[model samples]
Each structure stands twice: as C-alpha cells, then as structure tokens.
Target chain A: MGNQRDSIGDSSAHNIYLTNGASEGVRQVLNMAIRSKEDGIMVPIPQYPLYSALITLQGGTMVPYYLDEPKNWGLDIKDLEYRVKKAKDEGLNVRSMVVINPGNPTGQVLTEQNIREIILCYENSILIMADEVYKNVYSEGSQFLSFRKVLNGMGAPYKDNELISFHSISKGLMGECGLRGGYMETHNIDPFVEEMFYKLKSIELCSNTIGQLGTLLMINPPKRGVEADEVVDLYEKEQGEIYGGLKERAKMLTATFNKMERTSCSEIQGAMYGFPRIHLTQSAIKAAKEQGVQPDFFYCMQMVNETGIMTVPGSGFGQRDGEFHYRITNLVSPTSEMRATLDRLEAFNSEFYAKYSQ
Target chain B: MGNQRDSIGDSSAHNIYLTNGASEGVRQVLNMAIRSKEDGIMVPIPQYPLYSALITLQGGTMVPYYLDEPKNWGLDIKDLEYRVKKAKDEGLNVRSMVVINPGNPTGQVLTEQNIREIILCYENSILIMADEVYKNVYSEGSQFLSFRKVLNGMGAPYKDNELISFHSISKGLMGECGLRGGYMETHNIDPFVEEMFYKLKSIELCSNTIGQLGTLLMINPPKRGVEADEVVDLYEKEQGEIYGGLKERAKMLTATFNKMERTSCSEIQGAMYGFPRIHLTQSAIKAAKEQGVQPDFFYCMQMVNETGIMTVPGSGFGQRDGEFHYRITNLVSPTSEMRATLDRLEAFNSEFYAKYSQ
Candidate 1:
C-alpha cells in the first residue's frame, strides 16, 4: 500500500483513509476538509445527493455546475468555469470539485479531452475528488479511463493536479452494495493535508474490517498462479455479461422514454440511473401544488403508489429552474421486470398528462 | 417504529436511525443534530475522541466535563452542572449530551442512583445519546441497567429526556467488530426532529442491508420451542463463562496495577478497556521528548513497536492537563497472554522509572 501510493506521486496516499462505503468516506473526509469559513466544495448540479448532504452537515457551501442535459449530460467547461468563478466572486470559499464518472442520475462518461480540460481550467489549485467506482462497468468497446491515467497521459500540468480517486466493490462486478465496501486513493497530494485525513479518520477509528477485506478482494482479486484460469475466466465472463445487459437495458429505456411526448432522457453510457425529463402540463403543476408536492415528486409518488415501482424525484438531485426530472435506477429486474417498469412509467406518464397535464 | 416512538411520549426514541456500527450512527446523528447555530454538545472528558472530532467537523462546540479520575472515573455532577450553566449563561446553545455507559477508556459502570441524578440534572430537555454498547460486559452481581429502564423506573425528569440508546454487535457475545453492525433506539424525541432524522438518513439511502439483517438477528435471536430449556441453559452457561473470565482478568490487572508505584488504575466494573494512569518519571518524559512524541503516545507506540501490543493514547481521547494515560484493551490474548502483558507492562514501568528517576 505504501509503495503503491508513493508510485502514484501522492506522498500522503498511504494516509488516505478507508470507509464502510463511499457515503461514510464522503462524510468523514468532507467533514474534515470543510470549514465554516474559507472552505467549500463544488459538485455537478445533477450529482449524487451525498455531496450536498455531507457538505451541508459540515456547514460548508456547495457550489453547483450544470451538466448540459440537452447535450447528453456532457460536462461543459464554460459552465464549470462560470460556476467556479461565480462561487468565488460571491465569497463562497470553494476548495474541491466532486466528479462522478459513469455519472449518477445522468450516466455519461467523460471523454479524455473533457478530463484534460477540467484540469487545465480549474486553476486555483482546487482538489478533485473523483467518484470512479463505476470504472469497471463501462460498456464493451467503450474505453473507460481513470482520471489518474488521463492525467499521466497529459504528463504535466494535468498530472500535477491534486486528486483523490474513490473506488468500490459494490458497483461493477459483484453488485455487492450490501457489503458496504470502498476506498479512496489519493494522487499528487500534500503531506500535511494527508496527515489531517489520518487524524480525522482516527476519530472514527477504522472502517468495517470486513468491508476492508472486500476492498482487498476487489484490489487483489484471484490472479494467475494464485487461482485457476478457468475460474478467473468465468468470473470475468459473468461480469462482462452483466455489463452488457446493463448497457443494453439503459439504451433501450432511454430510447423508449424519448419516444413518449414531452418526455426525454440522456443516453446512459455508464452509471445505473436514467434521469429522464418529464414535461408537466400547467394543470398537472396546479394539481401537484394543490396537493403540496413538486410535480415530479407527485408524479413519482403516484407512479410508485399505483404500480409498485420506486424511482427518485429530480428534486432529490438538484435540477435547473422549472425543469422537471426523475431518476430511475436500471437495476429493476433486467428481464421482464425492467420492461414492466418501463411500461408502467410510460402508462403513468400518459395518464398523468391526460388527468393533470391537460 | 413511529408508533413505538409516539407511545414512548418522545419522538426521538423512534427517530433512532440504524447504522452499520455505533460509530457511524453517532457520527451521523451528532453531525445532523449539531448543525444549528448555537448548538454545543457536552461530552465526557477522556471521551471516545469521536465526540471532539465530529463536533469540530460540524462547526459545533464541545463542552467537556472532566471525569473524576480519583473517584473511579466517575461523572462529577457539580462539574457537569457548572459547565452546562456556564455554556448557557455565555449564550452557547447547548443541545445535547453524550454518555458512554460502561465508559470507554475507563470501564466504570454508573450506579442506578448516579444515573438518576444525571437525568434529574439534565431535566429531560437535553437530548442524550446513550452509548450502551458495552452493557453486556458488566462485572459479576452488577447487572447492566438501561438508561430507559432507569428513567421509567424512577419516573422523574429523565422520563421526559430525549434519550437515544445505542447498541452494537461488536463488543457483546459475538465480538464481531469486523461485521460493523449496530442500532440506535430513540426515546422521548420531537416528531419534527424525528422526521428530520429520517430525511437526513434518506440522504445516505440506508445502512448496509446485511448489517440491518445482522441487527435483526441481534434484536430477534433464535428460540428453540421444543428444546427451550437446553438452549437457554447453553446460552446462559456460555455467557456466564465469558463474563466470569472478563471479571477475573479485570480484577487481576487492576490489583497488579494498583500495587505499582507512580501508577494507579481503577477497577474495571464494565467495558473492555482499562484507562491506566502511567506515572512517568522526569527522565521518561525527557526520553519521550527526545523521541519527539507525547509521553503516552511515545509509551503506547513503543509498546506497539517493541511488543506488538497496539493501544491508543489518552491524548487521542481528551484528558486533564498534565495527566498522561493510555487505553489498554483487554484483547491482548487469553489468560496466558494476559499474564504476559501484565509482566511486560510491569517490567516496562520498572525500567521506565529506574531510568528516569535515577
């Protein structure tokens, strides 16, 4: 672990603490990193709620940048720069940016160029805490690259950017969310900052030892000489199939949703969620207001109540002003169940439009 | 859970969120609860360090009441009242208090009367996050009493106090710390506060499902209907043996330490640690300074480096001025290894004194 971290150009990489899950990791690290004065974190507007909630708990401000929904959930360098500049100008002590690769809700993988641009544009020496736990689950023929790899490929200004990469055993091959296992790998970090991380983690003592064991398993899976080639091949093959299924299901769902009137969704190239925009009618919005619920939330709750399908409302993840959306995870029974869920969503959308939207 | 909290006449009891371990539970709830402006939490000095670290993270203040080390690590009610009033008079918003029964570091179990006094003093308004994870390890003839039980039994101001009881699967019969399983039971909390807790927890979605399953196992253990008597007897017998062994070791270690000059340690009535006062000689302190470490840290690190005995420093947990201490968990080894530990500690103390005093 020490030598591996040293090789990564992070003198304090060895000091990066582990947690039961990325949630706990975020809570601890952010809690340590954020200050009420002169410390804040930037996150994508349609990002994981963990960043916002954890940041809130730490009494730190959250600076949000929009992921262009119309542009396939792509990162716009201009939007990023604008948000960072705005936050700084407004006296929000921004310090770090949380990037979700194979993004949550809006599941678009960043292009290598996008990654390089992010490094070059964010000039204030701000740290990047990359959530790359979904790195292993990319669709075949689509090359998934680590931020570290891209940075190393860039070889200069980008390579020197401070970054902390998070990985998990829950997402890719095992889908072992119940295991509550994850790790943070720091690259090109300062020594004193690393010591602070250790000091902060020491308060919580250590993460679940079992979860750490799972991390060990993920990092050092059965290799050649240690395990049979046939067994390893079977494991890899199973994961590949799972990845293929996820990709196919995501594409099919997005395409199907887009076919519906006033409903649209971005292509889910990576993560397990399909965040679809559902245009609510004026009547529907009025009806939802009467019931004291956001239109999307009302739609989601109604859909769940009627069809027994659960999907999070867009308000759960921040959204653009007046733009309604809901996030549905792709894990809904991959075979017949997913089709049923898609069908239910379509039917609900139509019914909702007829009754309220009209 | 909702009905149970309502029935208890306080919503906080029902608002208890479950986590993979008490550490995570405490971190989350405390972080959430202490977010208000003027929120200050009173924690016992020589605390489990998690308190200070968490309060610091949340930008909350920690008002500490020193444990009466001379009185078997007893809670000084006068000191507690003084601190509480001082904070209040100073306009610091004192929100809650954390009491670790079967105290960490120091293993003194609070007497029923002592608990009653604490409850009366708190006046039921202050939220109490009672950590009773070590309840099962009380000394022989000293039954562990829940704060809820004492509150109900006495029918005083404490019956109205917002109490959250925390328990873990790590320290009791299973000793499965690696599993990271625990639950918090809340009593006498506000409904709105409970809802807030729910909303906060939803931000993390849920604790590990398997850990929740383990909690279910903990709360609802197996019962053999036909072989009830045998099963009961078997359980009782195993518990008795473990409890008996722990008490025996506690007695042995306490007696041995008490006899040593410049060293004094209280009897461990409960809990897994022995927070012993290491009477360091001037020379020993000088030597530790030369090594560039806190005396206690230097001592503990030396113990770990030379003897492979891992122990935490008192500085990690807060301590009185100039009082150097180290936490020694009773997990050194079984009976034989326990003896070896005592021997090593004794020899180390003698050598340390002779070298320093000389």
Candidate 2:
C-alpha cells in the first residue's frame, strides 16, 4: 500500500487507504467532494463507464473533455479547459477532475508532461482523483508515471496539490480482481477532507479485511533468493508472457481495424482494451434510429449477431457526439481465438458496410 | 441464494441478485428506491449503523420507529404507524421500510405473524428491504422467518408485495465475512425497479465474482450420501459445533448482562451481538456532556481507556432519548477469553459506577 507513497517520497503511511477495490476508493473520494447538484467532476470522454455511473449515482454532474483520439488518444489540455469553463457556464460548480492513465476503453498511457500540465491546470480548490488501475500496463514506448511522482517532481504548490490516486491488484500482473483488492493514497489533502474519508470507510467496516491482506501479500511478495527463488522465477516468467501477449494482440487488433476501409483505431498504448472508431454509413445510422439504438451499439449488436462476438458501444461510455466507436479487450485467450475474432471482425466489417455504404 | 427465494416459492430465479456482500445489496435497494430528500425510509431505532450510514450517504431521511425494549425488543406496530404518519405530516415521502430481523444491536427476532403484519401496515408503494443476514441464527425460542415467506403465505396482494430480502455466507454456519458474500432476492418487484437494479449493478461490473461463486457453493452444497459424503459429514460436524458454541455463549452473555447491577440486556434472539443498556448516574451524564460527546459514547470511551474494552455506543446505533447502551459481539473466540471479557466487564461496571456515584 505504501508503494505509491515510496514512489512519491511520502514520509508516513497515513496517506494510504485500502478500499473494497479501486471503485470503492473512487466512490468515497467522489462522495466526499461532491455534496450537491452544484458540485461536478470532469471525466475523460469515452472513459470507463464506472466514472460516469458513479458520478450519476452520487448526483454529481459529469463534465467530459474529449481525448485526442486522432493522436493516439492523448490528453487535450485545451479541450479540458473548454469543458471546465463550459460546465461552469451551465451552473455546475466543478470541484475535481478524474484522469485514467492507460485509459479504460481508450487504452492510452498519458505522457509525464501531460500529467504535470493537469496538476498545474487545476486550482487548489479542485481535487484530483486519478484512476491509475492500469498504471502497470503501458505499451513499450510508454512508462507508467504516478500523478504524485509528476507533481512532486515539479516542486512547490504542485507537490502539495490535493490528489487521490489509486492502484489495484485486480489489474497489473497479479490480476486478482475476483478478490476485490485495491488502495488509494492521497497527496496533501485538507485534514477535514481526510477525516471524512476515515468516517466513510469506518462505516463500510473497512472494505473486507481479507482483500486488504491479499493486497499486502501482493505488494510485499516473498523475496527472490530468500527461500522463494523458484516462486519468484515463475512469477516473472508468467508476468512476462501476459504483458508481451497483451501488447502483441493490441498491436495486431489496432492494425487490423486501421486497415478496414471505414474504420480507424487509435494506438493501444496501454490497458486491456482497444477503442476502434467505426465510420458508420448514413444508411446504417438511419437503420439504428429506426431500431431506436445508438449507431455504435447497433454496429456492435450486428457483429455479435453474426459472429457471436460482443463489444461495448462508445455511447455507453460517453463519447463525442456524431462519433461511433466500440471497445474490445485485447485479452482473448488461446491465441487462435484472437486470430479468429479478428478474421470474423474484418469479414463482418466489409460485409455490413457494403450493405449500408451506398 | 435460493433460500429466501424458497420462502416465496418462485419458479424462476429472476428474483435473486448476488451482491458483493449483504451490505451492497442493501445499499443498492435503498439507492434505487430513495432518490431524494423527498424520499425517506422507516428504520428501527437502535438499528444497525449500516442502515443509518447508507441512508445518510444517499441523502434519504431516516424515520426511526422505536422498538419495545422491555418486550424482548419487540416491533411496536402502533409506534411504527405513528412514526410513518408523523414523517408524512412533516412532508417526507416515505417510500420504503428497513427491517433488520434478528436485529442488529437489538438482537430481537420477530415472529412470522409480526412479519406479515409489517407488510400489511405499509401501502403498496412502500418497498420492504429486509436485512435477514442473521436469519439463520435465531435463539432457542425463536425461528427465523423470511419476509417473502410471510408475504406469500397470505396469498394475493400480500404475495405480490415488493420485497428485497438479503442473506449472507458471512453469517449463519459459514461465517465468511472477510470473504464478503451475499444475495438479495426481490419478490414481485415492478419490471422498472428490476431494470434499475440491473443497471446499477452493471456499473460496478458485477460485485466480486469470487464472492458470488462462494455464495453459489454455499447455497448448493453436496448431498449427504453423494461421492463427497465424508466431506459433507465433516462440514456438518464443524457447523454443529460452531452453532452449539454460539448458542451457549449467547445464553451465557445475556444472563451475565442481566445479572449486572445497573444493566439489563434483551434476549439475543438472533444475530451476533448482545446490546446491553447501562443505567448511568446524573454525574456520569454531566461528565460526558462536559467532554462534548454523547453520554453513551463517553461511557464506552472511558471503558476503552481504562479497561481496554471497546463497544459501539448506543447513540451511534440510535437509542431512545437519554438512554445509554453499548453493543458487544457474543462471537468471542476461545471459551476462556469470553469468560475473561465477562468477568472484566462485571468488575469494571461496579468500579466505574462508584467513581461517578455522586
């Protein structure tokens, strides 16, 4: 749990709070900050719907800023500023921003420069709730950097910025999500806000004690050459294969989608999913409206109907208006299954597009 | 999962919704039914803090109906009706009622007739959220009865009552709280309400899959004469010992608390706790007020400070005006430790009372 603290040079363990999972931590932070309709949080467009769902559940307005899907799904500082101002103009009192690194659905690892800019962007009143569950899953060219690390490195007021960042054993090499284990560490939060977090968790009776123990074992695994050499070797070997396989499959899928006549996919820089934008024909859009569903949803439903494959529509995850994309995981097992999915997807794309393209 | 379900004789499993734990199910039901300050839920006074905490978190007004502590903490029907009318008069739209049977903190199990009457008392609009996690742990004279069973047993309008009753592997014979597993079954819920439940759960990406699977195994254990017959016998043997031990301990603690000079404890009809109301002196109340805390809180904190004993304050669980009590779990491990706790509590009571006698 102190792993994040070590990364950012925290002097004490007081900052870390173990949660039911990353989601619970996220809920607590959002719940603590957003007290009424006036409060809102900025979320990345095409985000993990958990963000949108939780915001709605907590009655907080979700102000979305579009990611630069054209540029490997990079953060667009200008777009985010526009969203903040736009939301304020609409009578929303925006208090926080949520940044998912190695983004869910988007699968983009943010640059260190981008992170620093995000911290410098928000005022002291706005807390940063960073969803870094996929921090350990970056692509080859990108390295996972903590918002805390970036903020601390910048020095001064940036170092003391209010930030609640999270990590999970559910993701990463461990993949023990079934156990529901995760931790959140805050950076320089006010004592009042800190007390509320404690009070909230005390009510949940401390988020399943076993999950916290599972996290402890994960963060402090048995040392190599200290009576666990064989275990360590096995862990390293399996972890290498999983990551290497994910990166390879992600690349294969993105390339395949890009090659399709009416589709383009941003690079899968990290995380498990690839979000591929589909160029829906006018007739397909018309057909979707007749069926009373979003175009991307209709497209995904068609693929599922034909090839027995399921993908989530962009609309379900909050996307830019008039754009259609679907999110698919790069985690298809038995390698051959992955190849077959791609083959079926390629065939379905051409066949379906030809039917409606004219 | 199929247990409260069996109580209602549901041919389909549509009613059952597995949750992260019983708390999650309870949270979801309350969240779905109560959307604003105009919405309120009738909760038992001296109830589980989880109900109070969750209702407060969701911004739902808690209309507390006092229990008859002298009558084995019996549900006072007239009192509940009065509370409901009062809340309505105050402009709160009370839409649901929470029943923590084998009550938490109170530890009183309602009879089947009581359960049926509760359903009849509420209009069609008021949903019933039954916290039956302790349904299987009734005292010798009491029998655990599901709200679903009572409702259906009456037939017609009663059979179609909107009810969400919870059960957990964390309680009963399994005692797997740290693993966090439970299920909630809805009886004759409107399709719209059912859709809302599904939508809300979909956001959390399905509660701890392992917990749900744990529940599935718990509900469908192997037959006695099956291939795993020996394992089944062993399980029964262990389970019997656990139950036998709990019953004995609960009996011993209730008697002990009653024997104390200034304390009286209601029967532990179900659940794990023995909530003992302590008669405090005027001086003690004054001292507590001087410290700026609830008298019960101050009393419990003093006990902790002096004797290293921790118990939940009655005020935390919502007690009658000016009454002081604290809750202690009867599930203490090791017979000797339980005895020591009892002995220490007895001696501390007299010593502490003498100090504040003036």
Candidate 3:
C-alpha cells in the first residue's frame, strides 16, 4: 500500500498486525505500555476518547497537551514538550505520545514539517503512537503525511525512533467500520516489545476472518493491469466518487459551522468530523451547572431533543476547562440531507442564544 | 434459544450481551470481577486455559478446584467449597466460580444433581460463570443440562444466585470458530454490575456486526413454518449430521485412548475433546525434567514430530502436579479419517512406551 511519490515508503509484512479495529490495536499498545499509574501517556486535549478511556482503564496517568484550536487545531511542539516535562516533574514515566494526524474531532491534517518537528521533540524518549486512520481523507490542499514516512525521511537517530502507525478500513473510502477491520504497523519498535504484542494478540486467537479479508481488499485494491480492465475501472470510479463526495461534504459542513452565530469551526482539513467551539452565554453555563452537566452536553441534548440532530459533547473527549464544543460528522448523506441538518443546527443555535442571552 | 423441554428455560433480551466470541465474554467478566490479587476466582483444574489466562491477566487469585478424573470429570461440590474456604481464609474475597459445562478438553456433561449441588455450595457468596459453548455436542445417552435450569428448579434462593451463561456459534454444531460469534446471558446479576458491564463493553463500541448477526442467527434459527420448509429441513439435517459425527468421533477417541498402553481416558460424554492421562515412565519424566519441560508437553511434542498430529499439553490447561495428560480434539472430519488418526495415535503411544519404559 506504500507509494514512493507520497513518501510513504515500504512496510514489511512482519511488522504489521491486523486487528478487529484500530481501537483494538490502540488498546493493545496502551495496555502493553502502561504498567501502573506511574506510567504516563501523552494525549491531546479535545482528543478522541479512546486514548483517554484506555489509559484510565489501564490505570496510567494521562499527560494531556492542548491542541492549538486557534491555529486550525495544529500540534504545538512547545505545548507537547511542556506537558512531557511537567509529567516527568510529577514523577511520571511518560512512556508514549499519541498523535492523531488528520485529527479526530479537530480534523486538521498535519503538515510534513509539523510531523518532523514532533519527531525531533520526542526523539527516543517516548514511543510515538500515530493514529492515521484518516490518512486517505484529506481536504484538497492538505495532504496526509504519515509519521513513518516523515521519520524514514529523517536520517540515522531520528529514523530509529520507535513508532506504531495505525490505519483502518473503517475510515477512508471503504467506510467498513461495522466490519471492524484495521491494522497497526510497527516501525523501529523494540523486537521484544513486538514479540509481546504478538503474544497479546494471539490470546484472542485471531481477528474475525471477514474483517481480516476486508482489510486485505482495502490495502490491496484491484489494480489496473492485474485484474480485468472493467473491474479495475469500476473500482477506481467508485473510490473516486466516495472521496469526492466526502471532500464536498467536509467543505460544506465547515462553511455551515463558520456561518452560525456564537460558533467558530476550524477548517475541516481531514477526517470525518467538524468540532466547533460554541460560545455559550453565562446564563447557559449557569443553567447547565444547575442541571449538573457540562454546557456542551446540555446544548447537544437540547439540539437532539429539538431537531433530532445528535452530536458528541466535547466534554466526552477532554477539552480545556470551561470550554464548550461539540463534534458533528460530515457523514450525513445525500448532500441535501446534510444541508438541511446544518440549517436546523443554525436555527437552533440562534434560538438558544436568544433564549439565554439575558 | 432457550428450550424448556431440554431444561433450558427462557431468557430475557435485556440480559443478553453479544460478543466477538465466548472468549471475549469470559475476558470481560474476569476483568469486571477481578479488582485485585485479593479477589479470588474459583476455576476448575484441567480447565480451559482461557479462564486461567484471563484470571492471571486481571491479577486475581486463582483458587483451583480439581474436577474428579475417575468419576468422568465430574464437579465435586466439596472440593469447590474447600477451595473457596481456603481462599477466604487467606484473606481473599472469593468473587466468582467458572464452570465450563459440556466441558472443554475434559468433555464431560454435568449431571443436574451436580449443578444443583454447586449452586447450593456457592449460593450468594460467588457469582457463577457458565461456559456452555459446547452445550449441544453430547454423546448418546448424555444430555446437556444448563446451570440456569438447575438453579431455577431449586426455587427462590438458588434462582436468585447470580449467573452469567455463555453460548457460542463457534462451538456446538455450528463450529463457526473463525466467524467469532457468541453471547452471554446474565441471570439475577446485580443491576449496578450489569451497568458496569455495559460501560466496559461500550469501550470497544460493539462486537463486529457480522459476528453479532451470526450470533442472532445461531440463537434464532429459522422454524419449520416461519421459513421455507426445505430450508428448515436442510438446516436440521446438517446440524444433526454434524452432531452425530462428533458423537461418533468422541466415542471412538475414548475407546482408542483406553485401549492404548499406559493411558486412560474418561468417557467423552460431551464437548469436542478427549483429555487422556498418559502414564509416563520414570525415565520419561526424568528426560522431560532434564529438558526443562512438562512430561506431557514432551510426549505431545514427540507425537507431533512423529505423526504430524498436534495435541495440547495438559499442563497448558492446568492439572494435578506430577500427572501427565494431553487434550486431543475429536474434530477430525469423516469417521474413516478419525479412525486412521486414532490408529496412528495408538501406534505412536506404543512406540513411546516401549522406548521410555526402562
């Protein structure tokens, strides 16, 4: 599946482990790395809950670094360095750093330079967990750059930095989330740790056969000359349509969110979500506190009740203290359907603001 | 899926949780119930390794109660009670007991009397985990009796005993192991504990959609009038043939092992395996000790090397110290093929005895 032109160089079969889903792979890595509360995992604030949840489940310390939402949800090397240093100061052994490129919720694709800087910052101090499941789902100008590719491009010591990159058939064009097909590729990971991973995986016997087969087809789709020309053509056409539709939906969702009052959304550069920061009035916050829930959760619940538009409250995924945000997917199909949903959301936001402005 | 005619009573939908496989359900329960080393889980010796492995992973104390080999691998209530008492005396909380019925590897079906005695022994002190994946795979004159049924029959106090009964499409006549489909039914479990289970399961989203659907079909197969009669007839015929073939193989395997020199196998009343105790000579034991491996492992390895037939060492499943045993599955298809394999086993066993007897 690697392409030299894209700088995603070769990966050996021995280093790859097929999992039920990217979540399973993520869980295994967290479980392997975290031994106690002393072991810390560096995660992004307003992150996918899987990382935080798994860390808590494994009894590990979460050393969170806030993503720069003002900078279109970009990674700040200084913020990461600060978090790691602070965690270390607290007597935590920060074992791993999780980087969700083409970020979940905050869907900004990382630049190659950003990736290189993060690699240099962590070096060999922590294992890099690269969650690049949305590698194929990028906005027009924001191309996906894999951590393995960036690390490989760097020479000697940097190249030897341990990294585990995850990909999923559930994301990208396949959208086979229900099938639970994904894989993790280990790069420069210690041989002993790799063996431990294999041992842990073998405890479950194997991933479901259907999911494994789906992963195979995803990574190695029909090639032009290797298969019937018509079959290859149909495959390419369908894949292109899916990608194009996703790109269009992402753009429309971002535009719609930006247009809403008291709400600001970073560009949906990649992945399926658009996490918009909502500016709730003091009364709304007070009302939410009275109800014993986060403001974002209250807003989301209200939206759901009023318009039947479900959203994930940003509190579920750890956000900065007192900040209100909600994650909405661009996956509502038929383009027109998504447009209608956005229209309802905009109307709801206006009514909410008017009701609570006093 | 419950049939009152066979003493398998009705189950509510709210109580059932679909899993990737019976293994996953077992892992979840172990994870939920085991909080610390002071929490003890009672597991049968000569048990399926899944229980032992999960208990160890969860860092819980494994209080083993050995099943009687001489009495056809029957559960002894006194043995269980003794183990529980010993664990409790050691300052451990005896949390749960695992009963693999229509036993794995041991292949014995529990009598209704035995099941009732077990329920009375533990009562409200420990939760019962019934691994009933092999409930349908029984020999002639042997019946699969669920612990749920026996407990319900015992009236109020026994019916209120907490139990989690697991069933799998991977076992029984389905044998869809690779598809990874199973479900666990919670009976009289604490509402709060059940809620915690739901929360734990939600971390992985849901089991694979395909596996869940497979489990649905397994529990609710087409009825004669509900679907085409031909389809129902075909399903019944195939299921019957598979069951009949397994029963025949189980009987044949038991007979062959009993006839072999210095080996004794109990009746294969149910389940898919034959656990035969191999009488390894002193010289053989000495040789195995020198090689730093269990005697049964050494014997199984030699058998594999000579005959290309693989069997799991009894040591893997836990057994009495100094006892040599191995678990061989009666899953080889076609009566003639199973017969040939048995002949090979007999020949290899004789040769092994002759070489090591001195």
DockQ of each: 0.52, 0.53, 0.75
Among the numbered candidates, top DockQ falls to: 3
What would the per-residue lDDT of candidate 2 be over residues B1-358, giving only the tens digit for each residue? 4653355445357767777789888887887877788898999988888988898888889899898999888888889888899999999998889898888888889987788778788665678888888745647678888777777788677778787788887884647887778888877788987888888877775567667778887777656777487888888888777777777788888999999978999888878889999999999999988999988898888888877888999988888887889999878866668889889888888888998996
lDDT of each: 0.77, 0.82, 0.86
After superposing the true interface residues, what Cα RMSD does each candidate give? 2.1, 2.0, 0.9
- Predicted structure 2: lDDT: 0.82
Q: Which candidate comes out best when scored by TM-score? A: 3
The parts of candidate 1 lying over 4 Å away from their true place are A1-16, A37-40, A136-141, A224-226, A348-357, B1-13, B33-40, B85-91, B137-141, B224-234, B278-325, B354-358
Winner by TM-score between candidate 3 and candidate 2: 3
TM-score of the first chain in candidate 3 relative to the native first chain: 0.96
Model 1 pairs in collision: A284-A356, B10-B188, B10-B189, B11-B189, B12-B189, B13-B186, B13-B187, B20-B180, B124-B161
Tell the DockQ for candidate 2. 0.53
Model 2 vs. true fold: TM: 0.93
For model 1, residues A1-358, the per-residue Cα lDDT tens digits are: 3223223443343645677777777776686668785577989979888898788766788888999887778799998998888988888878898989878888788887788888889666788888887753444435566777777667566678888877776884647877778877777778788777777777776677767778777766666677999989987787677777776788777888889878888777777878989888898888889999898998889889888888899998999999999988777656467887788878877887777757
Query: Against the hidden true structure, what lDDT does model 1 obtain?
Result: 0.77
Query: Across residues A260-292, which tens digit of lDDT does each residue of candidate 2 receive?
Result: 879999888888889999889999999999999
| TM-score, per-candidate, Cα-based | 0.88, 0.93, 0.96
